[model samples]
Target: MATSIESHVVDITTCAICLEKLNIPKYLPCLHTFCESCLRTYITAIFEKEHKQSIECPVCRTTVTISKEVNTPDEWAKVLPLNFLIVGLLEKEKLRDHKTMHGEELKLFCADHHTPCCSMCVSIHHRRCAKVLSIEDAAMEYAKSDEVKYLKTHLANVDYDVKVIIKDRSSAKENIDKDYKRKQRDLEVIFSDLVAKINDLKVRREAELLKIYNEVKETIDTTLIFFQNKQKNIENEKQIIDAAVNMASNVQVMIEVEKLKKQVEEHKQVIQSKTKEIVNYELLLQDVENITKLAEQMEKACQISCKKPNTYIALSSVTVTPNVSEIFSCCRFGQHTCSWGVKGAKQDAICVSLSKEIELYGLLSYVCKDALATCDVTATVKDDTTDLVVVKDTIDSKVAENNTVKIMFPKPVKLLANKKYHVVVVMKGTSWCYAGGDGETVVDSNGVVFTFNNSPLSNNGTNTNAEQIPGFVFKISDEL
Candidate 1:
């Protein structure tokens, strides 16, 4: 058995192509071993001649693929570290032969001299020189030193620090995200409140402006009504005067000799009565002179003018302007000159006595009992006046047994036939003695009182309540 095994082993050790001990043996996947040179040459020749991309093993004709598996030799067992089984299979002599033949030449150089050296030369000659070191010697020493050991320790510390830093970074990022969300919520609430407040203020301002506009409109309307009435009165007065002048001229033309003689006797009485009537009318007109002036004064007090009316009347003829002063006299009384009165008394009560006329108008008719007293009344007539008729009167006060006073004027005088008029009254109480000494003056020393009522009436009739006064009234005629 020993003899037969020796022969088999010898046969396996020899290369089929080279016929030499299989040095640098390369085993195929077919379990056949061959010389490395022979296999390399064969693959090269086949690739060059046939342009084949892959080859088959000689023994089994299995495809010898050139991937990781083919790139490694089957005989790599000889190069690996020896174990008990490996040593038994391959003799020490065969192993040495494999290494000597297959091992690639390794050329080591001195770092300083740049000269190649063998392994024997590195161990003996490069021992003492500082710069004269071999690549192999340096590599071996670096692998075993404390520097390598320290690098290992540093690498472990670095890994631990990196893990701690990563945790902290993640936690900080989470906190930042939470804070940002909170701020976003707060901003939304603040913006909503601001928008609501702005809208409220806008609504309030709009309401206030609307109210002011309405008030202004009402004032404008009132002023317009006042001027419209004045304009109508002016036109009416012009027409009345023209008619009176025409009548007088026609009567003068109708005079005859025989008729004149008989008419002269009758004319005296008629003329006398007519003159009295004229005087009474003139007095009535005079009483309201101050009131008319007051109206004009009141109109002037306002700065704005009335808008022009849609329609207007024209005056056809002019009349002689009467003397307004001849009608009423202004009087001032009292220590402080705080009271104003207008007075005119005529004898013959039937001749429209001033007392009766004053009482009739009810201007100052409140003080009728004290018409004559140790007192004086006064009035003020303003310039550039309009629309106020002032009437003054006195009457007996049933409650106090003293004289009561009154004053009044028209609110808005209407224009009739181109003429407008107003009346105002003013009065004050005075001390009087009956059967005793001077009567005790009432403590109501604030006696200066004035009242005003408006009449659009063309002529003075019975006094009416202010509320009863008609609105604007006028007759429109083309000729005025």
Candidate 2:
């Protein structure tokens, strides 16, 4: 009987509708108790399934009518009264659950303190809080929950984010490495060019100094030889006088004394004049020293460098050249004419001036007509003043296609900044393909014209024959 009474105590607080401890316990007309949420759900299900406006008790067959004022599903619970007995039992059980192995039970949760506290704690530390629950009730419902599956998912996301950050960092590092190497190469090239120019200047300066040195050395050696010969003649004449004084009569000595004296005087005057001529180069030597010192100071004061690569510049944008006629005669402008070997050889010359250094990366042009078979077409880049050829290329005219194409060099040319280069196109060895053009003409100091029986490849600088065909189009581009 005691055991049975204990079972009733445990079960009394549970609602038959929910099988859980009764929460917000409500009493029906038949004296059946239920949780408010469970009763609402049962009533809704019955109305939906049977079109009934009332619910029958699960334990008893008593039926209760739903009030007309119950507009929402939640309002249905309002018609039922609170089950005070069930509520009292729930409170009693909550206190029992809070009881720990120790005699004291933490029977209250203080909202203001955010903690579960015993009655003593509530009276002292959380006295101002209006409401507090027993620890077992408050902790079960209010504590932020932990679910293993959700925790694992969140941890996986954090790890994935870290990996993505690492990948981004690695890519950034690679880009930095590439940039570093590029800058290093640029520095090396710049210094190399500077060193080369310095060496060239040194060689030229040495040549000039050597010429002056040779002239000065020759003059000094010639003066020394002349003076030395005079000394030998004077010594020989002195010996002859000494011998005459010792052995010959006084008359012989006296006769030669005056004549020899006059001769010695003449030799002395000639030596004095020659000595004056050689000794008067002090001003000239001083000028040379001052010029050298000034040159040294100038070099030290300035950074010497050619123009750096800057804005992108190009050649003619027109891809095609204008022809004189259908058969290609000269219009208001001139046409590039190659009259085979019979007409002899003529060269087409063009000049480009650049303000900054540039790499001759590529060329684009159209070959309007190339019919000659054995003709060799050649091109050259040269300085206008010294005729120093910088680069030269040649192609077999027989194999050239008629469409526009890019002409590439095996190695690109590095053009110095602030200078002009003369470009010459030659048609040689029976080659008779013309680059025709006619609208405008480019006036260049380096442009010239020439006619010769030999191949145009043999020439470097422009001659009197240079002509600019207005409509001719050639394109140039830099690598960077």
RMSD of each: 59.1, 50.8
| Candidate-wise lDDT, in order | 0.33, 0.46
lDDT of 2 by residue, 336-414 (tens): 4432231345665655555444445334332334444344345555665554433333343444544223444323466
- TM-score (C-alpha) between model 2 and the true structure: 0.23
- Model 2: number of clashes? 12
lDDT of 1 by residue, 1-480 (tens): 999987787777777777877655667666677667767776766667877756677656787655434433323333322222222223323322311112333234454443335555555665444454444564444345443234334333332332332333344334434433443343333234434443353344334333433343443333333334322322332232233234322211111111222323343333233222211000001122232234333222212111211111111111111112222211111111112222432110000011111111112222223335532322212212452333222333442232323322211122232122343222233543121111111111122111222333313221332111111111122211
Candidate 2's error at 97, in angstroms?
99
Against the true structure, what is each candidate's TM-score? 0.18, 0.23
Write down the TM-score for model 1: 0.18
